[model samples]
Target: MPSISQLRKEEQALHALLFTQAQYKNYIPVKSDSLLQIAEAYYRTSSDSLHKAWTLFYLAQYYRDSDEKEKALSYFQQANIASRNIENNQFKFLLNLHWANLLSDEDAENKGIEKYQTANKYAILLKDTLKQIDLYGQWGWCCLLTGKYDCADSLFNMGLKLSTSSKMTYYNYLLNCLSLTARERKDYKRALELVNRSLSLAKDSTELYPLWNNKGEILLEMNQYDSAHFYLSKDTRDYDPYFKATHYLNWSIYEEKIKNLPKALEY
Candidate 1:
């Protein structure tokens, strides 16, 4: 059996998807700082082409997750170059996926969707279930962002159904996303129910924090001011870049609801 890196051109694309799957599972930036340093030194000295490309991509991802966007972008480009001789599209797809995410968050939704859809074709060719499901979930969020609520619902439900055998964490996330659709529909009661169900499924506080924030947002939409404040206040912990942005966004909205206009602006 061939390793992903040694697989044929099309199958080698699985390398990027596999790397992405393992990202959420083993990512620990602070703890791996020294390890990364050692890895970098080894990469600098190593003569193996395969190791060089792999290390480049890993460093790119590390820098990306650490919020060092310039370095991440540089390394991603370098990694692509390092692997240019390989008969595989994994490197290109990996770069495109990250670029798509950045584009989506920066308001270039159509460009982002194009990249994501292009990558989805590779995922489908590989029969990568998790990647397929993740695309649906992410694409659904993009739709949600564009106020296509019904389309978002269809995509998210398809993702949720596909992920039935996945981890509880993913299941809860889909539930949380579904509640977002409900919240957007102004079905506050349904939103509350969906979020509460996610809370019940959460294994720990790390999982609960986002749901608390979501619940708070739903309560605010329902005009339950005090209860909204209660849940929102529970999520005081600083989160990763994406979640931190969401935290501030909800906080801003909560402040706006309470008529604290100045404070809302501050967030």
Candidate 2:
């Protein structure tokens, strides 16, 4: 038999491969089914409780991403029970965070908030500074999306205070989120400034897309029609199939705003 560590490593690699497939393509149906079979093998063979928990979590996530929420929730609950048998706070925190995000998407906001609050407590208990910063980003966005601006501000600023000088991506994520919050509150001037700062810090196209789109939207809100078109046109690269649809939607809206019905129809 392989050493348990070696087995876990193999399982982790398999999970990463499956996760990447799911991210880009929604899923590879055949590959996903094979991975689940492999996960079941791990669950049956592992005597270690933590290893069992880890397999369960990955299976749950795959199911969730594949739109099998009921099955996902069942496995997640099993994972949670198994996780409690291990003494690792980091593991516990991650489980809580994933569960929280799922619940949030299911429209169970109160349950999601409770799970996030528990994850933050676990982060503090473990003294995991990076996890602390990440939770701030996660929870801040949660609050922002739910129309809780004051709560979002407090969480983002707290994360900023704890962030180290070397991590620009962390700061970039926070600024983009904060800019959106400002935009939702109709502080267009503040939103423009914050998003521009975010764009300046971006290290790649992934970071650039959201910020560029936000700037264009801000210009549209400000009645700067030509500037809006200019900035929005800059976001020409196809991000992915799903996001390409979003790009077309944005362009269509922009054309409507400019009263170009023919162009809107073309978009």
Candidate 3:
């Protein structure tokens, strides 16, 4: 039989792997089924409430990423219940933040906003500026999707004000959100400028695709069909469903503009 120390070490290692993958958008090296089994085993064996809560949280994240929404919600509820006895404010904040994300994806934007507000209280308590910035960005995106352009503008600007050169990624993300808000408000020039600034901060081609797609959308709205096509085409190979959908929608519009009705319909 494994010693308690050995079991704890294994659980900690599994937690580190899941946490890194969840936080950084990195590809998981282990197979999902294998990871799930290990996490479940840890959850079953751990005597610590905090460890159980952490395991459940990661299990929720895995299910969420896999689009098993019902399972994810169940795990999140379990995690929340398990965490009630703990005093970890940072963990509480992260839990609420991710729960908000899931809610938002489920079209419960108002509920998500409430969760974000709850998370923000913890963020304030912890004095985690980076986490606060991330919350603002995510909250602003929800507002943008709900057509609350002014609200989004306010949230993104607030985040931008707190960001600096050291946090270029957050700064760039805010710029992108602000650009979308500008576009929604019919300020095409401002939208273009903000997205261009985001593009300037992009570190690699993977980051560039979405920026190019946004630029293409702005150009499409400006009636610059050729420029829109040039930029939009750059994202054709991107496999993300959201990006692909946006590309198809914009491409349809471009085709329509060029009087290719069949092509537009095909897109």
Name the best candidate (by TM-score).
Answer: 2
Give the Å error, residue 232, model 3: 1.9
lDDT of 2 by residue, 51-82 (tens): 67776777777788788998888888898988
Which regions of candidate 2 deviate over 4 angstroms? Answer: 1-31, 41-46, 164-168
TM-score of each: 0.64, 0.83, 0.82
Candidate 3 Cα errors over 4 Å, as ranges: 1-25, 29-34, 41-45, 165-167
Task: Name every residue pair that clashes in candidate 2.
Answer: none
Clashes of each: 0, 0, 0
lDDT by residue (126-179, candidate 3, tens digit) is 988898899999888888888888989999998998787346468887898899
State the lDDT of candidate 1 residue by residue for 126-241, as single tens digits: 67778878878887888888898898888888888878866524778888999999999999889999999999999988888889989988998888989988998898777568
Q: Give candidate 2's error at residue 88 in angstroms.
A: 1.8
Better of 1 and 2 by TM-score: 2
- In candidate 1 the C-alpha lDDT for residue 9 amounts to 40
lDDT winner, 1 or 3 = 3
